[model samples]
Target: MRRLAILMLLPLAACSSSAGEGTASTPAPPPTSPQAPAQPRDLTTNLAVPWAVAFLPSGDALVTERDSARVLRVTPQGQATPIGKVPGVAAAGEGGLMGIAVSPTFAQDRFIYLHFTASDDNRVVRFRYDNGIGPLQPIVTGIPKGDNHNGGRIAFGPDKYLYIATGETYKTHLAQDKKSLGGKILRVTPTGEPAPGNPFGSRVWTYGHRNVQGLAWDDQGRMYATEFGQNTYDEINRIEKGKNYGWPEVEGVGGKPEYTDPLLTWSTDEASPSGLAYAKGSLWAAALRGERLWQIPLTADGEAARPVPHFQDRYGRLRAAVQAPDGTLWITTSNKDGRGDPAQGDDRILTLPLP
Candidate 1:
């Protein structure tokens, strides 16, 4: 692998302020100056289809395997141990045990949450992890599921509410249905009820997404998400409360007045984006089909600058990118996910230091 160097560019006056949603605009030119080189090191190898990563308060990480439904505890020293397999996972196609999140108040609650494809639907559940996984308690349930597009990513925002990303389950009409949990980002309390200040007075935060797998928040608490586009373009969207992303109605930058546009978009061949993380004034997106990491720099005002791509084809298929508690970036590969040609030690987690 080659050394990765990021350019810290100054914000341009032409850059749109992170205000209302609009179509993808021209980005500012790349910076003339370059930062120090950052290199990625494989933290663990020979893992099954690892999907999501969450960091414990102790600096350890909890990783979920999509097909196996197993959770592994990974130490900072690169040691990986299987803690337990979540029961009742219906591993198929793009569904299974997908996302895992350590509670923001984990030190006090000892609760870890998971999103998985059950027999009937995709659901979120929590278990108290003292030394081992406790009995399961379902929080959010009845999310639509399908052989594909089983959007399953969960995280706790800075507000302490749990946010969920759900797919339309190949049912495009569901994207427009606020009453349906499919194709929407749901915000709920710890107990799975609708959050107090939710837009629709229910769990739906935003709707009209085809398949959103990545969610991240900037320092200012602004939310962003990565969505898989249907054969045309992939998107990085600046999420707002109750806004529709125009999924089946449109893809990429529609420039339609009624629907919000994406902040950035790439051709499907260049980016099947997933697992987004915010760090060092940039949004890092892991690409599955593109087999690279994209660093999208942000201005002081939170507008997006030119995006830089790194590690193209060096790693087979990148699935997840997350910022660790210690400030390093951790990413997982997805070569073993049936769509890619597996390399030696096909599925693995790699770590890189940020500038």
Candidate 2:
């Protein structure tokens, strides 16, 4: 151990709880400061349209291959093994196998939930994971699907209910229709039933969303979602149950009576927001057209500050940004998703320390 030679005098510290009389002990030398920004590293390469990643309790990641409709169990050593195929996935433009969520009680139930585009609609299903993944059961279905704007991100909230983000599929009226699952945030149980405390007594938690692709929660258990604007504004919203988010009526902020304004908004060119993750007291939003990660520092109550962009244009078309169980930020490139130019190993999972 190195010797500590301090010039300033200090008061005597209390002895350890187990110490005898007059036996003094140095207090845990003031807890050290936190550290970050340890250079990004590619965990796995040669992925095809990787959309979202969810970690198993064992720390192996369950990654969704959007176009192929397959799930790969990616190990920490950059090795991937095909766990199994999510059945009935029909791939189309921006619609296919999209988001994944491992059960909060996965150690016992071993249930994995998946969001995918079917032949007619986008849907959610739960499947058991034994040695292989199989025996799919419908969780929620009949979300209107189209070539684009099929929002598919699922996450289990701190309340232990699954939250699903759905796009309007370019249908203008569906956003305002509470009866339709399209363009709405749906909350349900693991078995596909409406969560008990849902605002409308149905799976539709909040209506009037154009395209919501990202869902995250802060330390205070408040929810936040990233939404795609029509042609002008991209937005980050503080989601509350049963509250209306102005979509077809208002793009960004109208401050209307029936609608909740977004917490933060950006130009469409700057942030075509997709996957979002809350880590290190900030919301990290991924962009597709912007091809960058927006790090927006958030207050305890989930207020947003000026966002700082990192890894802009260096990596082409980021689609998914998530924080792994071990506190690492994992991002996926969307260059191969028929939108941007594909580089060598075009799509991949890049892991970095949360800054």
Candidate 3:
């Protein structure tokens, strides 16, 4: 494991002018230079179907393997040790052990949350994960599941609430139906109760989603999500509390007044976007079918500019893109996930410089 020092980017401070009398105003700082292109470094190469990674305060990480139902504790040097197996995980097409998130208060709580496919449906469970494994405590359950479209990205938001992203389960109408948890992003307490002040007085936060595979928050505390489109386009959306993103009703952009149009969209082949991370005034989206990493520059007001693609077709089918606690980005490849052709060490974690 090679260690690199990262330089933090600073914004220019506002300059104030004194009242006249030969008083000169100070000049604003020069524009910051673009970072040198990040060279991808292989952290680990011998992993099987690794999906999501969550970093601990100690700088160690917890990684999830989708098909194996295994949770691994990885050091910064990329040494992986099996912590324990999640009980009763039902691995099917596009499902299994999907997303893992550590508790924000993990030092005291010692809790880690997992979203996975079960025999009957998809669910979120929290476990007391000390260095040793403990019992799995079910939190949110009964999310509709299917062979595909089981949206399984879970994270704790800036509000300290747990957010679960769920797919519509191949049923288009579920996206528009407010009653079902399918095709919606849910906000709940750590104990799995509905968060207070939720729209419709339930756990559902936003509705009308086809399949949302990513959840991220920018520095401003604004939430963002990535969506998988049917055939025409894939999407990145700015998520609001009760807003509905047009899924079944509209695919990409709809001028319709009822639903919120996506902030950005890409061709289906160009972006089957999965995990996303907001860092350095941009959102980095990991593409699976497109097999690229996209960086979307953001304006000061939080509006998105055109996206710039990096490492196109360089790494095969990028699965997850996350900013580690150390301020560098870590990404995983998914060529071994029964989709694309796998290369030698097809499934490996790669580290990149901060955006």
Candidate 4:
């Protein structure tokens, strides 16, 4: 509840240049595997258990490590520096330092937002970094958390609202609870107040989600989310206000009439959909258990095509995939940090140039 002074990092104009050009508005072709397109010339490697990656106003990238609780400043030249450590982070089985996003008004106020597990709950906090004085202070808190289903992803919508993703944390019914901020997308003002004009009158934007981990917006202002399913299916949903994504009631793509079905769903073994990003008019999803990058072409409406796998064995256990400031897709490997088999470099971030 402590109010902290805000600091800005990069200006809006600085971000517009890199962001507006990288992702295209045209429809992308479906991914083909039997004959993988020749790998792009630029494929930068070396990152570790990178839970999330955010682009700074200055065009650099901020990458987070789930188990390390460390926030790294990754440069365009591929050099990474430890910016600062996150506080109140509880690390363990699939729980730890999770998702991160830069404030929309980063130029005027260098505020950084983060989602991580605390001792008792998973919460969102905003802080400022000034080099000498590490992390500034807490911006928000009081989110529910558990070992397995702790959804921790945050992004800024085009309207500049901060959208937070959360999980039910084993409490299946919590997803449908309006009062509780769990298993749903939450919309809030930059300062953490419930955003005005929210569908539920509360922070809840949509409900009935299991463990939503990734979120992104297209040029057309459409929102897409990637979710981890319980047993059968993993989903890529085109999110709408007030809609419920079937969770405990129905596993993945199909569910009750009242709930909205996913735009694309993959079997559990094929995709444990985690991090997501929109690049070149297509949605790219990172899979943990599947260990591949699923490139999903979207129709103008935002419904995703059957996913096309990219870099299946080349990259180990893809965790986070974000469009970088350089117009290239930044992907993080999660083989290290104790989850998947540790690839020599285990947790490393890679850059893939887009066409």
Q: What local lDDT score does residue 80 receive in model 2, on the 0 to 100 scale?
A: 86
What's model 1's overall lDDT? 0.85
Per-residue lDDT tens digits for candidate 2, residues 1-355, read 1111112134323211111000011223322333335667889999899999999988899999999988999987779898877888999888899999999999888999999999989999988888577888888989999887889999999999999999888897999998999989999999989999899888999989988999999989989999887655678888998999988998777768888888877766667889999989888898887788888777555666556678889888888888888899999988888778899987989998875
Ranking by TM-score: 1, 3, 2, 4
Off by over 4 Å in 2: 1-36
Best candidate according to TM-score: 1
| Residue 62, model 3: Cα distance from true site in angstroms | 0.5
**What is the TM-score of each predicted model, taking all chains together?**
0.92, 0.89, 0.90, 0.86
User: 122 in model 1: Cα distance from truth in Å?
Assistant: 0.3
* Per-prediction CA RMSD (Å): 7.0, 14.8, 12.2, 11.1
Candidate 3, residues 1-355, lDDT tens digits: the string is: 1111111123212111110000011222214433544788998887778889888889988989899899889887888899988898999888899999989999999999999999999999998887856899999999999878899999999999999999987898998999999999999999999998899899999999999988999999989999888756578889998999988888777768898888777766667889999898889999987788888767666766656678999888888888998888889888877776788886889988874
Model 2 TM-score relative to the real fold:
0.89
With candidate 4 superimposed using the best TM-score fit, by how many Å does residue 196's alpha carbon deviate from the native? 0.9
lDDT head-to-head 3 vs 4, winner:
3
Task: Supply candidate 1's per-residue lDDT for 318.
Answer: 88
Ten residues in a row with the worst lDDT in model 3? 15-24
Q: Is candidate 1 or candidate 2 better by TM-score?
A: 1
Off by over 4 Å in 4: 1-47, 132-136
User: lDDT per residue, candidate 1, 1-355, as tens digits?
Assistant: 0111122233311101111001233455446322432989999999998999999989999999999999999998899999998999999989999999989888888999999999999999999997677999999989999888888999999999999999888799999999999999999999999998899999999999988989999999999998887755678888899999998898877778778888787766667888999998889999987788988877666667777888899987888999998999999998888877888986999999988
Residue 282 displacement in candidate 4 (angstroms): 0.6
Candidate 3: where is the Cα deviation over 4 Å? 1-36
